[model samples]
Structures are given as structure tokens and as C-alpha cells.
Target: MTQTLEHEEVRIHRGPRSGLPLIVAVHSRALGPAVGGCRMRRYDGWRAGLADALRLSEAMTYKCAVSGLDFGGGKSVIVLDRNAPVTPELRAAALTDMGEFIASFDGTYRAGPDVGTSPADMVVLRRSTPHVYCLPEEHGGTGDSGAPTATGVLAALRAGARHVFGSASFAGRTVVVSGFGSVGSRVAAGLAADGARVLVSDVDGGRRDAARRSGYGWVEPADALGTAADILVPAAVGGVLTPETAARLAVRLVVGPANNQLSDDTVADTLAARGIVWVPDFVASAGGVVHTLGRESEGLDHGAAVRRVEGIGDTVRLLLKGAENPLREAKALVGRRLPPG
Candidate 1:
């Protein structure tokens, strides 16, 4: 069956010169402004890119809402090739384009960086637009959001392990972190730092080697998830947790920073039947939201934002004990409330 949008609004703009300008689906008018980071990914076509932007934006909307933040969700996708950011000039051009594209919406839907984008990259985009939020300290922004994102993910993973395997420590437990990107790399480091034996895997050999040097075990991408680890964290691409991979899982709990970690709701049910306590993707992987959370630059008083996300433990525990999954409960709590920030 085709998918239907329960919450969100989508907008598309194709630049006359080249590249497609996309504002993914945004959810909630309750939030003053819909805030999100922009991502430049390798897409087969504009249509595919559009779908990705729309879906991610919607997920982000609920992510912020459930975290109890007032910001709505929005995203931008710069479609080109896998090697989109080749040189300084190329990267600069992309950010410049983003500034122009996103400026159209003003603050209605804000965009940052994702996938191949970085905090430094956001600075370039900021030059063209003052609307940017996550910047380096030099640019009057905190440099590393990866750390906060990783912290939130790690906390959620611990919560999942406790609720599922009835264990609180990861002394002897093994965890495989796939796709060690910006967030994933930090997550791997954080987990290892937490005394968990972490096996790092990424599409980029350089990054994988770096992780290995950081005291993490290394494995090929496919081999990473197949191990008999107590926990399996997918920090890789979306849709990797389909039936085939889902069935191959030998871990007790799953938590990671990948978007749409499951292919769909079916993956959740499959894991449920197999007795694998699968943490909801949107709920477990809310680190990016925490890192990106802000209202005033001088110092963002997130209040309970970090606690709220780490507290996803409570929600996960409730889902484990209740009839519906954590995502359902989160969906209900968020309640289409993306009021302006």
C-alpha cells in the first residue's frame, strides 16, 4: 500500500540553474518556527530526493515534539552525486545555494547539515543567512554537536539494554555500530568509553580505521550486524533493517542514530515476535535533535531537552510493558504539536 501523511506539509523548489531546492515535509503549526538541518545526499533522481526530504522532515517534527521542544521539523536535500562535496569551492557553492533556497521560507522551516554536512559547513551557509543556529564557537556557535548527539544515543542504548536484557552494564557485552558517520563515530567512541566492546564499521575505510585506532574492533560492513553482540546499533543508512537483515539480527536490543532505522513498522513487529526488543528509530535516534536544539545562541536553555530524550528510556520501558510500541506512545504524546519555537 502507498503511504499517507498523518502529520506534515511538503514544499518543493527546483532552481533554474541546477540542483533541486527541497523543503521536506514539516509538521505542526503550534511551534513558532519549524527548525531542521539540510542534508546533501547522493540521489538517483529529484523525485527520490523529494521523498527522502519529506519523510525525514516529518520524523524530525515528532522527534522534537516528543523531546518536549517547541520547534517543528523541516529538512533540505541537495541532490547531486555521492562525491558532492569535492573541493572547498564545490562545498561553498552548495551552502550558498542552500542559503538562497532556505531563505525563501524565512524561519518557517530552518535547515542545517546532515549526512555529508558538518558544523563548519553550516558556517558557510550562515554567511548567506543569519537564520543558521548550529555554528562553531568562532562563529558564535558551539563547534561539536556530535558529542551531544552521541551522548543521547548512548543513554538510549543503555536504557534499551536494561529494559530488554535486564542488564545495566556493558562490561562483557559486544555492540556493532554500523556507518560510523559524524554521529555514529562519536557514538562508537562514547560506547567504548562506557566500557562496552564496540565493533566499528563504516562505508569509508578511513573512518573505520580511525575507529579501530580508537580501541574499537573492526569488521566489514555486512559482518558488523551479523555478530552475536548483546546489542546491535545501526548508525548506517535508512532501510537497512528490512526482513532479511531483521531476521539475521542476533542481538537483544537495538539503538542507533540512523534515520528511519527500520524499513517500516513491519520490522518492529518482526523483532517483537523474535523477542528482540527493538527501540523505535525515531525515539532511539533523537540525538541530532538534541544537538540541534536551541532558541537563543548565547546559551540554549534546553531545560529538560537532553533529559527528555535520555528519558526515552521511560517511554521504551512503558512500550515493553504495554500493548503498543514506544513509537505509538511517542506519537500520541507528541500529539501533532509542533508549535513555533
Candidate 2:
């Protein structure tokens, strides 16, 4: 194990056999045990993975705080080899190693699934750690948070629409959803069902095909960001809205489930200056955490959790209408609740 501690707590672990490199960052323990997902992906380098872990862990803290969860922020990133095929054996070995690493944290950190990870992987993780969540429904855990997450995004989108266009209804509105993955696909479908002119795009051919089969207008990945629409949703990955991209955005509102949506913090101000209403990603994308809290905490079931998640719309509305800077306001909301070290 080789660990580099930032102002926030962080741990780096290497798999004994698979040589898997993992970074765990615990941003806070003020409210309770740190809670976040474990993201497995190929990074440019170990340092890049470490940076991602740090950024995501801090976001997790704010996410929990904004969602009214009694948990701090933390995240784990498993670095993979891009050149190597991630076979079943490789995935199992890597997850097993990660589970053991998580177990060492005791109860201070709880792990769940993120990008490139799934409920099935959580089952494997549960073999080594009792703190794993989002396991298979048969295992008494929430199977997948995609539905709830989409619900939250939908709610937030409506709220943003109301704030920006003075209407909450999506009827006749064009919603360009970039990245038709698990959560993005749900979001796009929900918008379409609600009578929105939904346009979809994804880097993967299969995802684009899925969008087409679902009757959504397919936009190429290259033009998705520049599409003229009522709302531009970057649901794929982070840093898509850099200062340059924000300057060129044609939408009135920018809202999506992608974490760290702003390439740089200043991009929020830039968007604001350009007359674009930017809903903070943490507030809009907190449905999964709400679901997790309901499952992990006492007296809250999935239905109740979903109802709680719906409150995100109201939260976003309040923040957008009141706060001068929604991002800073969201962070302040968490900072006020955080306990002193």
C-alpha cells in the first residue's frame, strides 16, 4: 500500500495478484461514515486516478449533505489497463481486491457501484466487505439506482425549466441528452414520455442504436454538445462544459446527472454570464444517494426514498432562485452541516 494524504483523507492500494491500483478518498466524517461509489475505469495514469478520487470524494460529501443524508463524502477509483481486455476473471479479481481494501476501512467508508461497475460486481464485493451497497435485489440491496437517479434528474430539469422559462412542463420542449448510458437512457426515455422532443447521443454505437430503437432522434456525439435545444444535458462524463463549450452552448438551461459537470469552477460563472441557468450537478444527481440512504438507514423504503428524491426539484428551485452562485451555495450547505475535525 502506498498512500498520499491530502487535506482530506486518501488511501491508495495495489492488488497483490492482479496488480490493480485503487484510490480511496475520504473527504469528511462530520455527519457519519463516508459514503460514495467505487468507479472502475482506465485512467491516463495513476495520478489522474488519484485526482479523480479526490474530486469525486469531495463531491460525494456535498452530495450527501445536500440530499440530507447523515453521511460524509468519499470515493474510490480502480485504475484499469486500457490495452488489456477486462475479462470476467480480471474483473472478479480486481473487485475482490477492492472489497478487501474497503473492508480495511471498517465502517468509516461504504462502497457502492459507479461507472463501469454494477450490482453484480457489488455481489462480489460483498463477499469481502459488509459495507457494499447496490447489490442484487435478492441480496437485500437496491439492485440499481439508475431509475431513481433519472427520476431525480427529471425533477431537477423541470425545476430548472420553471426557473429559466417560467414553465415546469416539458411538453414541446427539446431536450438534448448526451450519453445514452444507464442513467442517461432512463432520462431520455422519461423526457420523451413526458412529451418532450428528446434528442439522444452517445459515443458508443450500441447506445446510439438503443436510442434509435427507442424512437429518439439521434444526434452525433460531435454535435450533441452544440445542438440547439431548450435544455442541454451532459449526462455522459465530467468536464464537458469547459469555458469554451459553455460559451457556445445554445440551450437556455444546463442540467444533467454528470458529476463535476463544470470543467473548471469558473465555468459556472461563465455560464451565468452567458444567460444560461446552470443547475448544480450534485443537487440534481443525488437520487442514487437518496436511494442508498433509504436502504441503509432505518424507516425508509424504496418508495419513500423516491419521494424524498423528488424533493430535489424543490431544492434546485430554491437554490436557483435564491443563491447568487448555486454551486457555492450547495457547497456552503454542506460546509455548515459538517462537524469540525
Strongest candidate by TM-score: 2
Q: Tell me, what's the RMSD of every candidate?
A: 3.5, 2.5
Least accurate stretch of 10 residues (summed lDDT) in model 1? Answer: 294-303
> Once superposed on the true structure, which residue ranges of model 1 sit more than 4 Å away at CA?
1-8, 16-24, 81-90, 294-298, 301-309, 336-341
Compared with the true structure, what per-residue lDDT tens digits does model 1 show for residues 156-219? 7877777776776676788888887777888777777778998888878888568767888887
> Candidate 2: misplaced stretches above 4 Å?
1-7
lDDT at 191, model 1: 74
Tens-place lDDT digits, model 2, residues 30-75:
8889999999999887788999998999888889988888888999
Question: How many clashes in each candidate?
Answer: 11, 1
Per-candidate Cα lDDT values, in order, are: 0.72, 0.87
TM-score of candidate 2 on Cα atoms, chains taken together: 0.95
Q: Residue 184's C-alpha lDDT in candidate 1? A: 82
Error of 1 at 56 (Å): 0.4
How well does candidate 2 score on lDDT at residue 61? 86
At residue 249, candidate 2 shows an lDDT of: 90
